[model samples]
Target: MSKVVLITGGSSGIGKSIGEFLTQKGFIVYGTSRNPENYPDSQFSLLPLDVKDVKTIEKTVSTIIEKEGKIDVVINNAGAGITGPIEETPEAEIKANFETNFYGPINVIKTVLPQMRIQNSGLIINITSIAGYMGLPYRAIYSASKGALELVTEAFRMELKGFNINMTNVAPGDFATNIAAGRYHVPLNEVSPYLKPYGNTLDLMNAHVDSGSDPNMMAKAIFKIMNTKNPKVHYKVGAFMQKFSIVLKRILPDTVYEKLLMNHYKL
Candidate 1:
């Protein structure tokens, strides 16, 4: 039988590539995006959805279930980025970021879990980031939201272990995606004095994003994970440096790693 897969934020970037790739591989793929018109109709069915809205999530899942009868996989890839020091970021901005990046996936999972549990088999892939593991200088709020998401991913993995459900977290490094271009920013003028020193780091972050790994590579990694008989809990995808960074952080002392990161950013 063909596997049925649903992907959120699947109009473009990594999500779109994954949906296209999976569709070509013979999976019955459905992709959701806020702007459903942006998705190509020939490749995969497009559903209108805003991950931040619970009603939208519930309706989308209901429609998919009604059409397909069974959902084999759900990829929570709809998320946004906020770039600014935490102090400079307004509470409203922080809440909005969390609503999209953190709560959005949580809501989707909650809506889908009941059906998955009854079926006793399902795969969930969360497209998180390396920021989930470590904090960066400028994107404090973004990092926090991802960190929270990672924790949720871990918890779900353990909780769902006995239910015959699988959860995988893809922690990708900086990728050449529209995320950088679409990132929300707040003016530093209104922030507390404590956040002033991080301005230079934010500039460097923006520059680094322009030269990050290709989104296609990340999509390929996700494809491989989805096809696995038994996928691991976490997979990191990026350049050699990113792989090395994760390794170095694991082995190096806190002070040593901090120094390396600071030097790398010229801080």
Candidate 2:
């Protein structure tokens, strides 16, 4: 039987690309959207699900299990992005970003694991961000949230080893996607002390997404991981430099890495 797959936040961006690619590859793919009605043209099944909401996640999982009998793979791709000076960002917004990016994915995994455990075979892929590897100016919240997920996945993988329920984190660098448009940006305050540098960094961040690699690159990377007998605990897909940045963090001293980020952002 073809493997059944479920992707959260699958209506567009990287999730949509993954869903479409898997569909073409002959997997029984189901993509979740808070508003599934918006994507009538979607190539695969688009079901209603909001990662931040447990009920919707449970319902979507049950629906998939009832229809497919087994969920062979799950991609926890539903996430929100927030950018702002750590001090200026509202507490509620920070928590909200974590809700979608961190807590949300955990909820989805918890809801589906029982079913996956029953099958005695499954794959759980968490879509993280290259930004998660380190804190970035004006994007610390997003980085922290994704980073939290990455660490948890490491622990989760070991816990699931005995059951054969594999889990991995795939961190992608900026990709040409609608994430920028959806990201919550604390308005550039005319009088705020960070107006100049934050504004510049914000513009730079958006530009990177616009010029980033095709989403299909992420799609293909994910497909390859899904096919692997033992996917690594962590994988990254992006421009060489972006992936290298992670390595730089490991080999470079803390102050040096900080300087590199400061220079890149022109802070």
Candidate 3:
């Protein structure tokens, strides 16, 4: 039987690539986007979905289950990024980031768990980031959001072990995607004096993103993980720097890591 997979935020970037890749592999792929009209008809089904909307998520899952009978995989790949210092970030902006990046995936997981538990077979992949493992300057809120997701991924992985629900978190570092261009930013009109110091920092981060690894590489890595009989709890993908970042986190003391990161960004 063809596996039925639902990917949130599948209109573009890594989500879109995953959807396309899986479709080629003979899986029935259904991708979610806030605006389905924006996506043309193709092998992958594009459904309307906004991760922030709980009611819509429930409805979408119910519809897919009714039509397809079962969902074999649910990839919580929908997320947003907000770049700036925590102090400079507005409360509402931070809350919005969490709603989309953290709570959105949590909502989808809760909605799908019952069906997955009953079937006794399923895979849940959360698209986290290297930021989840280590903090970077000017991305305080975004890092925190991914960090929360990382915790959720581990908690659910342990809890669902008995039920045979496979859970994996893919943490990609600096992929070349619309993420940098589409990142949510506060209007300059709303910027306060305190945020001025971090303007240069955000610019530098943006530049790095522009030169990051290709999104297709991350997509391929995801495909490989999905095919594994026993997927790892966490998978990191990117250029050498990203892999090294994980090693640094493991070997270096907090103080030393902080200094190294600060120097890298010239902070």
lDDT of each: 0.85, 0.95, 0.87
True-vs-predicted CA distance for residue 126, candidate 1, Å:
0.7
Which ranges in model 2 have alpha carbons more than 4 Å from their true place? none
Q: What would you estimate as the lDDT of candidate 3?
A: 0.87
Q: State the TM-score for model 1.
A: 0.92
TM-score rank, highest first?
2, 3, 1
lDDT of 3 by residue, 155-219 (tens): 88999999999999999888778897778765543456635446667777778788988788977
Q: Estimate each model's TM-score.
A: 0.92, 0.99, 0.94
The lDDT leader among the candidates is: 2
TM-score of 2: 0.99
Summing lDDT over every window of 10 consecutive residues in candidate 2, give the lowest-scoring window. Answer: 78-87
- 129-246, model 2: which lDDT tens digit per residue? 9999999999999999999999999999999999999999999999999999998989999999999999999989999999999999999999999989999999999999999999
Candidate 1 regions with alpha-carbon error over 4 angstroms: 40-42, 188-199
Backbone clashes under 3 angstroms, per model: 0, 0, 0
